[model samples]
Target: MLAKHSKNKKISDKAFITSGKAKLAISKYGKENVINATLGVLYNDLEEIYTFDIVDQEYRKLSSQDLYGYASSITGDENFKTSVKKIVLGENIESNFPNIYTDVISTPGGTGAIYNTFKNYIEYGDKVLLPNFMWSSYKLISGEAGGGYDCYSLFDSKNNFNLLSFEKKVLELSEIQKNLVIVINDPCQNPTGYTLTEDEWEKIMDILKRACKKTNIVLLNDIAYRDFDNKALEFKNIFKDIPENLLIIIAFSISKSFCSYGLRVGAQLALSSSHRVIEQFREASAYTCRGIWSNVSRAGMQMLSNIILNKNKYLELKIELDKSIKLLKRRSDIFINESKDIGLKILPYKSGFFITIPFKKGIDSKVSLELEKKNIFALVMEEGIRIAICSIPSHKFKGLASKIKEVLIEIE
Candidate 1:
């Protein structure tokens, strides 16, 4: 009785479901007894959702019209577009690659930016290239676009970026498909917290430059957690001198950066050496935005533009964000050092919100369920159990690794 595409579609977000269970546990037992490391949102030591004060002040300054009015353009407000490029690309794109053509389109969240790219670029039955350990939504998004996906091994024997596997897969897919789409979640990548080094990016560019000769390439960089990494802008030097056939999309999110998770504001900034391609992107992306979701939150866009453009407000926002970064570092140190001491294995995590503990392929669900019985909630993935270091308080991180290790031992 349902339409073909709508029928037999199973949709359940494990992170939200697990987080719900964690909340129920907290209600049953005191907060001190439960560890809810399911969601990626920042939580203070007092177990409250943390918000940036500067963001709050600026948001309160917005006029009624700014809050309720439609965006100035389908591509987003002009100021929002300019501010996004400034914060994300900084001076790298403008100073280094003055000739590159760039355009920005506003979307609901980072997920919207990603989905828009997939819908416009991916042809039917084409597969996207992704990392072996990645946000599960990438696969779902691709499927919804009438396409599928394949993954390159994310790590190697030394627990580093698997450049060899990446090269092989990139070449293989480019040869098979007329247009290639690849997603790289970098500079505090989700789940695994792995950031690609500049050298690794240089190597990736070499591969892309070579592949672009055979097929048009789309590189989607989901930088939802970039604000948490101090070296984020430094690593973007690789964005320079990209081949004309390769288009780069930087997905920017206000959820983590502005601490405006509920506002759902984000943008897709498309960069290309070809003016014609970027022009096409601007038109296509705006059309998709109008069809799917007419316009993003105007209040969110106004708030971001105001803060980013004002020097004092921008400085205050940075100061507050630095504190959260320090807290994240402390939590990461405790868990990582303790994990090493107890001989618990975790994926290579440079900097980010989540840390993953890999296990036998089919045993992750059982492991997560067993941990839930102990009131420790983490997300179960195909490769591991994802522990949200961003949500866990630094004090709670002290003996947490050992407890999880014990459960892992018992389950295995």
Candidate 2:
């Protein structure tokens, strides 16, 4: 007799291996000296601003009973949860749009959130639509969910996600798949750092609405680096009027926003008009949560709650964050402008911590590895090198640009 659940047994490819550039940078530059333009981490000094006195004191005052109690059982302690909900949902709910629900469950990190959401919604043989160039986690999570579906390429010859091409793919997928989830990363996309313009978002949303009107589909908006853009709230506001027919889900993370990566706190907000549908979604998500990590880190939740509850402190923290974001933008502007001056080609990047540089001759990953010999670290994607700009110090921008130019010359 065949062993039960044998079909589900498979080798794990979900763990994201660190990029080669990251390892080289850490080894050569001693971690601190090397500019880490590889990960989506904010390097601004703002910890003091986010520090909370009241929360600390209150936390200390809590007895053993509080530690063991359910968060919802505390009748008067709803404000912490409410404040975080507001920040994550933004103007999407304030304008009478379908609001995002926060009580579904928690996860160790945003990746966990993605995995749980996929587990809850996807079934074997079901198809999930994704952009050709997306965060690698989407593929890993989707595979772990059930090993179903295929990715549709969204890139043009110029290596951009073209609207016309994307729409064509959606139309084709609609013909074959009844249950579909389309994932879109907006505002400082990981690995690419491409932020969609308001007009671009509008066009895509309109097309998705039209397509889903005739088919069963769900839209998952992964705003992992939403905080990197100064106008994150404004961009989120544009989604307020999305049609109710299209099932919408927003995955929000505090990792990049508050520089709380180690905390691993993230939330999934499901937007739907049907109470029954939302309820089922919540139940299924909770089940997945139990099966996986069995809920998020309690300490992480407390830290986030503390930061949100103290408004004055939060504003102070935002001010410091604003300063860091401005500095990051300055570094990005320097890199892009200097590269252009030297006749080097790069993608159009407005917001986000990364910039993509496409090689004219189409170099392979092995040749890209040679970049490490010059002390320039970068994540090599299929199209080009993705340089993380957030960690690059402002003073060193010019020197880094010059080195990259020299590398290009040598490679050519």
The models' CA-based lDDT, in order, is 0.90, 0.65
Name the regions of candidate 2 deviating beyond 4 angstroms. Answer: 1-35, 44-81, 91-95, 98-104, 148-161, 233-237, 240-245, 360-362, 405-412
For candidate 2, the per-residue lDDT at 245 reads 57
TM-score of 1: 0.98
lDDT of 2 by residue, 264-376 (tens): 76777667655666787777877776666665655556656666667776676677667767877888888888987887777767687788776654664553556666665
Cα deviation at 79, candidate 1, in Å, is 0.4
- Candidate 2: how many backbone clashes? 1
The TM-score, computed over Cα atoms with residue i paired to residue i, of candidate 2 is 0.82
Q: Write the per-residue lDDT of candidate 1 for residues 278-300, one digit (tens) a residue.
A: 99998899889999998999999
Give the top-scoring candidate (TM-score): 1
- Model 1 / residue 4 / CA error / Å: 0.5
Q: For each candidate, give its TM-score against the true structure.
A: 0.98, 0.82
